[model samples]
Target: IPQFEDVKFEAASLLSELYCQENSVDTAKPLLRKAIQISQQTPYWHCRLLFQLAQLHTLEKDLVSACDLLGVGAEYARVVGSEYTRALFLLSKGMLLLMERKLQEVHPLLTLCGQIVENWQGNPIQKESLRVFFLVLQVTHYLDAGQVKSVKPCLKQLQQCIQTISTLHDDEILPSNPADLFHWLPKEHMCVLVYLVTVMHSMQAGYLEKAQKYTDKALMQLEKLKMLDCSPILSSFQVILLEHIIMCRLVTGHKATALQEISQVCQLCQQSPRLFSNHAAQLHTLLGLYCISVNCMDNAEAQFTTALRLTTHQELWAFIVTNLASVYIREGNRHQELYSLLERINPDHNFPVSSHCLRAAAFYIRGLFSFFQGRYNEAKRFLRETLKMSNAEDLNRLTACSLVLLGHIFYVLGNHRESNNMVVPAMQLASKIPDMSVQLWSSALLRDLNKACGNAMDAHEAAQMHQNFSQQLLQDHIEACSLPEHNLITWTDGPPPVQFQAQNGPTTSLASLL
Candidate 1:
């Protein structure tokens, strides 16, 4: 409907962006198609629209279409002489390749992206944003590929880029729906900033506290600019904050406080379910972990199943699979599905410091499965691998779990001296972390070690330690699980039946969505 070619080209680009923002691929496709058609006549438009279409397909999970679009975008970028767009498109394509598990295919695209960004001459600030996105993408690639040394440089670059973006023009933000004449500013740039902050927090690469602080600063900046009403953008901040709060409480040994935070998260999702899909899935998975720690198998199962149902991200799905595998292993199911899933997901067999925590859990849980099945040699191998990986990491719970497994492996192999050494280290690490789950596991191992050695005094001391830790854990839980004084449920009977189910669709759990 635009009369001029320029107007028509701009209209198509804007329409495609709007559709992408709203998660409306069907609505965005025709606009992208028109843009592609127009670009054939005008080569300049071709580079931009082709890149946009590539990203669109990536978002829609249509990898083949995205690859085709990226090929065109790469070609058009060369024809149109735009280094910035070329770098951006290549990075997008590289990430898609990484997701497809095509590890070899990503390096060339990432190298090209780096080359283009290094020479780009757009406004220094805009060029810097593009560079930051690429740097973060590169970091992700390294992390996923287990190239631990390569990650630090990207993290350093990202820190510098964050500082630059903080000083960017105040006019960069705009109302989400009004779509004013904002030439130098793009709304999606802020969205990208939110994502970068999130990745920094999740990876714990460099300056996590600083990243959280920046999130607060960004939120304040958005508020001052009256952009707080942007639901999708606002949801991103809320999601990260909620997750951080829960993790902080759990890590600090305030299990009760952490459980209470889950209630608030549930409330957040109930208010705007679609807006918080990613967070909802993540919360459920965490809740399942909490349930498992407390020996609530039914609740844990419900939570894990729910998490798998709610989201399709490979990482999220992998977490659920690992947890459920532990559950089934404990319940004596021997199909080996969990082992297969972990092997598939962890093809590179990485144990980077950042992911060492997850790797520890995976290895320790599978080792426990082997131990229960009396495969002592297999258990010893898995547990020792997990222990070796736990060194130089800050994951208190995982380190504790690994040590406990190592102790059990030593005890099984009839090495009492080594068993004692492992048990003592495990208990010390478990004590450093505030999680009752690790405390219980460590104490149980200590008691077993004492009993095997026929040391009555050592056994008695361990029993006492176990009693104290158990009491501390239960007291924390009791305080945390208490409902508000005003909303407390007063029962005329002793306790409600376990079979009583809440209506309203079986009480959708955070685990169920994971």
Candidate 2:
């Protein structure tokens, strides 16, 4: 009879896996619940089942239930005297809370997790793994807060921790404790994750070249690993790397390549329904950025709207709303919708955006709206706020955007000298970022300012620079629009279009694109 019960427990796990693979999570959940109920006598199976059920809830974006399950798992682990597994459960819950921007709740939880990792006198490898997880969470928390400077120490510690892990031969060592049997990730995978987080930090700090360097290294490793082993995590890493690199491409004036890579992300997601469900909103957001860059306001609006509808993440929602407001502002209609969207993301009020960069961007959007309404004084107030926040965090992209817009405002107000002062530094910064759109805007303003000041020679030089930027953007736009995948912008619901799926490997090599 006991053997039959064991078979039933094993059967439930295997069956649920099959159902989940087929995208029948509805069928999988009940089976998992039944198994969990029956497996309560076996702590290991019960804990595993609880974690599995929690992951299913997380995948469905039902964070409330997921957190509850994690809480149960944590308490169960504590009762079983498995501090290591308890840390895992608590950390997982912290991640979900962080995702919802419940920072006040997450802060104390992370502190408790930190204490657990410190006091844990378990297998050295497991301790280091828990440390890596804790450091990663800390780094992510700081980065989300737009505290680039504040995150450096934690990042360095993480890097050193991974190095320590790489030197240890813990892979074959079976821990005496059953709960300590789990490995967080293989050394190679952890290395790639460290590179990913480093790339994220570099990108936020406006170190585009550095971001690209790390991305290239990470992708090369991913590609090689995927060839040897077809792990789903590899695909997840690949998609995320491509997502970051594509944004770099957009900023650095590689729109055609960005579009190609966006399709590649779509194709990668299509191979797994879970991946698609988790990333569909983000894919649409990328498409919206492409549409915005190419001046396709209509397509941009549609893409942002779809992303807004699909996403439950508070920060991502605020981001999408900010972008959608920009599209609305550019169209010169939909004033009512724009106002409502702006109200929701007003940084001073509590729309619950914890990211410093996004809050600064919200101010920039507010300034942009004021500028369009011809409220120069109000616009200047908002833009100045944006500059202060961006400068504090070294958010170069937002700083560049705010500076250029302020210069435009000054130009319109006929303060040619002040305009020149704002536009000149903005141009220099944009050129450093190689942000084509901002560079183009700054160059045009420089040309106008020089012309007004009777500096004909300087004016001609500025005009030539503006012309070149325009031509380059125009060509990229045409190339991007010509691609079949451009139609992906129109896709709002369901799976990715089959036509966009890569028949061969990626159409473009990740290394070359980087």
Candidate 3:
């Protein structure tokens, strides 16, 4: 009877396979558990069963649970001296960490995995598979650090590994998402990551259309990935894609439509709590930003506060606190509370936000509050710091925004020459992004400053630019109202997950594959 355990496992595994074929997790899970129990005496198959269970959890966007299952499987492999299974579990764990944006933790584990896989005389396909994943993790790290040069070598190595494993044995597990049964899943995912990183870099460089192009490509690939089993990664990619879209829309003189898009997403999330709870913090934060764009201070404040309350992630908390402080400054209320939250800012605090955006946000909010409270000198200090950091990070949009704030500080302090100088570059940068609102305000200030100094020609030019921006903004509103409301995005989404956002997965980043 004890020897019959393998027979029992095969039967249960078959039933589970049937359930999986139908995408019926409720039926599949119990069967998998039974199979795992039956296969306990067979460590190799038991580990495989645990992995299948973890994959199910991953598909459901329950990455934490997936990690737990993999952990147990790893320990079981080690106990049984199953080197290949241990290495496989480690690779899966590393991928999960990479998806979680825990970059610091990923490298060490992946390095060890590479060593173990290399030394062990295991299945060649599995070794190549681990090698490919390891390279991807490295590539991701380099991209996040904005070192495109460093990524190329790793990418080359990954491609070579893929090319080497041209044929798969019937016993081998296929490497993550294969496109059209020819291209490996890792290859597709690498392309997705490459496009996404390039999009973010392009945005920082103030190349809006280039960023949009890359975003469209990345979104297309992400949609294709949804056809596979893992929705968690795909869902995270969709979030990042939407963030890029909103930013592009806001800057390219489509603020009204951008606001409408975020509003629709927020409303959809609210109606479908499962589709939103995990991403509530980001969704609410985006809504707050839209409200701020429309000068809806009360609504923005509420949305930001809700976002803050929803997230327990330390970095996201910092990001939300900064936004909330901005809202408080805008309302000219609760200065002390704003300062209290701002006090947590260390500039050295581990920020998971893209390219020092969190630090820029902190300084900008601090400067704004100081400006509102009439502490001109303090405001100037913080605003300058904000600009320095933004420029250092090559975050062109934030730098432009900071320059506008700095110009305002100068104008109020009777430093007309400096104010005028600041506004000129700020307007240039704003025009590049086509952020009409910033351009409008900066040009208006320049016009007034020029007129007050009795410079008629310069005043007229500034006045014309301001009027032009106002008209452009009005035109945008009209176009937005005239266009039909249905989403024109052409990509196909996979079958909607029954439990969409579980709120319990690993915290990646605010605007990441979170």
- List runs of model 3 lying over 4 Å from the truth: 1-34, 37-47, 55-88, 95-104, 113-190, 200-206, 220-236, 263-274, 344-355, 452-455, 477-514
The TM-score values for the models, in the order shown, are 0.71, 0.89, 0.70
Stronger candidate by lDDT (1 vs 2): 2
- Model 3: weakest 10-residue lDDT segment is 486-495
Best by lDDT: 2
RMSD of each: 7.9, 3.9, 8.9
Clashing pairs in model 3, backbone N/Cα/C closer than 3 A: 177-185
TM-score of structure candidate 2: 0.89
lDDT of each: 0.63, 0.87, 0.69
Q: Write the per-residue lDDT of candidate 1 for residues 404-477, one digit (tens) a residue.
A: 77787788788988988988887776555444566676687778788888988988888888888778777876
Please, what are the lDDT tens digits per residue for candidate 3 over residues 1-514?
Answer: 7657667666777788788778798999988987887677776468667877998888787888898898888787777776666777877888888667777777788888878878877456656666666666676565455443445567567657656655645345543321101212454565575566567556655668878888888888787787884745556566666776776786777766775565445444444445576676776676666556556677777777777777776556776777777777777767687667777764546444543566776778778777888898888888888787777656677778888888888898889989888888999988887667789889999999999889999999999988988898888766644333212111112221222221465432233464
Instruction: In candidate 2, list every pair of residues with a backbone clash.
Output: none
> TM-score rank, highest first?
2, 1, 3
Tell me how many residue pairs clash in candidate 3. 1
Best by TM-score: 2
User: Which lDDT value does model 2 have at 135?
Assistant: 91
